[model samples]
Target: MPKTYYGKYGIEVRTNEHNHKGQKAHVHVYIHGVEVGAFFLDGQLMVGNVKRKDRIAIEQLILSNRDEFQAMWDEFQKSAY
Candidate 1:
């Protein structure tokens, strides 16, 4: 997993190739240690567990760095095998 960005409020965003079964290439957001949510690299929330107060910032973070995250995912997959 590569951390793509970090923000205030202890928010961190990361992308990983080895998510649970059935998950797509996605970004995971964490606050403290708990996973706040999982989102597609395109910035769409695949499953919303994100804290309400942090949703906007997280979304913006994803949207702003979608391409970089996607690239990281692609590279990770290529190197994985």
Candidate 2:
């Protein structure tokens, strides 16, 4: 698992193995331990996890700093897999 900050909010990246039978790759996001949503692992707009209060901020960060977040995710994957 890995975590990052967007202003005062927190975003987490994590995966659950065997969560649903034959589930494809995906990542989950939580806001201060609240399950916001899960996204397909492809890192595309087809998947999004933005809450009402933080949606705009999260979207901007995700779009603007994708590389940094992706790098963090890569390291987490290395540790997990």
Candidate 3:
């Protein structure tokens, strides 16, 4: 997992590359080492639970840096192979 964004109050956004069979591009949101949510590049939540304020912050972060995050995901996929 690579740390992508660090925000106020210990919030973080990171990308995880699945090194095994059947994995898709996604990001993980964390607050103080605890995962709050996992979301796709398109800002769709895949799993985990997040508070409303945190959810909005995560979505906004993704939206603002969508292209960069997508590119990172692509690079990570290539590297995993």
What local distance difference test score does each model get?
Answer: 0.62, 0.54, 0.65
Candidate 1 ranges beyond 4 A from true positions = 9-17, 20-23
Q: Look at candidate 1 and give me any clashing residue pairs.
A: none
**In model 3, where do residues sit more than 4 Å from their true spots?**
9-22
Q: Looking at candidate 1, what is the lDDT of residue 9?
A: 24
Sort the predicted structures by TM-score, highest score first: 3, 1, 2
Candidate with better TM-score, 1 vs 2: 1
Worst 10 residues of 1 by lDDT: 8-17
- Residue 21 of model 2 has an lDDT of 31
> Alpha-carbon error at 79 in model 2, in Å?
3.6
Candidate 2 backbone collisions, by pair = none
Cα-based lDDT at residue 73, candidate 2: 59
**Pairs of residues clashing in candidate 3:** none
1-81 per-residue lDDT for model 2 (tens digits): 456665565556553332443344444555666767655444443345565657655555566666665665555555533
Q: Is candidate 1 or candidate 3 better by lDDT?
A: 3
User: Local error of candidate 3 at 71, Å?
Assistant: 0.8
TM-score of each: 0.69, 0.52, 0.73
